[model samples]
Target: MTFTLVVPDLRFSRQAGFNPLTEMALPGLASLLGRADRNQLGGQSAEQWLRGHFKAESAGAAALSRLVDLPAAAAGHWLRADPVHLRADRDRALLFDAGLFDISAAEAEQLLSALNSLYAADGFEFVMATPQRWYVRLPQAPDFHTTPLSVVTGQDIHPHLPGGPTALQWHRFLNEVQMLLYGHAVNDAREQAGKPPVNSVWLWGEGPEPTGLAKPCRSVRADDAQVQGLALAAGLPFRALPPAFDASGADGELVLLDTLGRSARQGDLYAWRAELERLEAAWFQPLLAAWRAGSLPRVQMILPGDEATLAASLGPAERWKIWRRPARLEECLVMGS
Candidate 1:
């Protein structure tokens, strides 16, 4: 069985006097790094890579995620309208991910109700799949493209709004929604409670579902909604990533281990190092043992960051090449950066 491990931000920003490998020993990962073949998979965020893997047409996060509920026959008929998460900064609005917000389901419901009331006449409706994940359905799909939210976190959103033929209409709609939400009672209550208000919605992922998508792996194990959604859409078996790896039973499975992305994005090198050590003990160590014991046939590590991805292919023979000394994790990060 082939195991594909997707590790986001495996590389960390360099510090004046910091060495990750010195703090934690990751022999397994080091061995793989030492002998495995490396290849560059272009420059794209992890989300963009997944979209390409699933053959998704719409670049919107909503478009790819909405496929989980859409039937195959009606795939191309409807466009996915995902909610944009915005933070009300001092003077300008900041675009960020939903994970950074503290929105509750009840609060989302209240805010969405007001939005739906105003947008219903425009043939737009909002649905909150989760407090963090919101959606909107368009009567007729708009002809526009949007930047992924991952790329714009912590930056002003005015320059990154949707663009295309219907850009004017979409911008107007966003202004109207922001105005309505700004004055809603929910925002007032949130302010009183010392919470960030849901003041605006970013509409994006406006395109039809992809066609002729093929499953890349036999089975998928992941914690991400997009991975699970892609598995569902492709008619493949999927399970949540188990806390431990059972090398004896892992065959023909894809495992997505997302432990480092958050810290890397936040530029918290200390936290990034801590998480890397934990992953080293839990994953890399055991997997290396399995590969050395001939229990595992092949393992592929896909490390994705904001700009590029590094793919490493490892096998039993590669691990035994003691001449290829293990390099520090910092070295890998520096090369990638």
Candidate 2:
């Protein structure tokens, strides 16, 4: 059987001082890295790569995620209208995604209620899937495209906001929402308690019902709503990522490991090290043992980073490649590019 592991922000380096990422004692990863046939895919996002794998290049994240997240959102053109925080930095406004902050169910309810009431007559409805994920269902899908919330996180959002012909119109919508959410009771309470305000919504991932999606793997193991949505759209079985790597049997399975992303992006050195260690202990070590014992045949690793994506293929035959040089973990590693 064939197994594939997809991880984001794995190929990365520290900004300064000791680079714990390269120093991890991942014997399995090191062995595979040395033996696997490696290649780089420049300028491609891990999300986009998943879309390509599932042959859903035409699909939008909103439509894909909605299939799993907002199932009641039937018969509608949808867009991911996620809550965010815009902070005034030195020269530009940085977009802080919902993951960077916290919002309780009560806060989400209060915030969405005010928003829904204000826009009830505007030909759309605001639906909250989770505290962080919100959606806008429309009668017809818009023609413009939008940046994903992940891509916009911790970056200047001036150029990433709604673009295309509807730029002015959506810009106005953003301004109006900011005005409405400014100093609301929720924000007031949040500021009083020392938390970031739920001040704005980042509009992105617009989509019409994603069709013609093909299942590329036997099953999908992922924590991402968008990935699960894609699997569901393609009629593939889906499961959440377990604590460790156990294929538990699939002819070919697609597993997404993205937990390392948050700490890596935040540049939390010790946290990053700890998460990597967790992966090494839980996944890589066991995987190597199984593969060496011939329980698994072929393995594929997809490592996505800011500058490029790396693909490494491994097989039993690779064990015989004694002449292969030791792999450099930092070869494709680049952080915060």
Query: Tens-digit lDDT track for model 1 on 161-211?
Result: 888888888898888887888898988987899876777766655555445
The C-alpha stretches of model 1 lying farther than 4 A from their native spots are 12-24, 54-63, 69-92, 335-337
Q: Judge candidate 1 against the unseen true structure and give its global Cα lDDT, from 0 to 1.
A: 0.70
lDDT of each: 0.70, 0.82
lDDT (Cα, tens digit) per residue for candidate 2, span 1-337: 5788988877764466656655567666777777788887765678988988888888888888988887876677788889988888988888888887899988988988888888889877888999989998765668677898888888999889788887888889888888888868999999999998888999888755678988678899999999999899989899999989894773388899998878865768789789888998898878777776777788888988666788888887886788876566655355443
TM-score of 1: 0.86
Q: Where is the poorest 10-residue window by lDDT in model 1?
A: 71-80
Candidate 2 accuracy as TM-score: 0.94
Runs with alpha carbons beyond 4 Å of true place in candidate 2: 13-22, 332-337
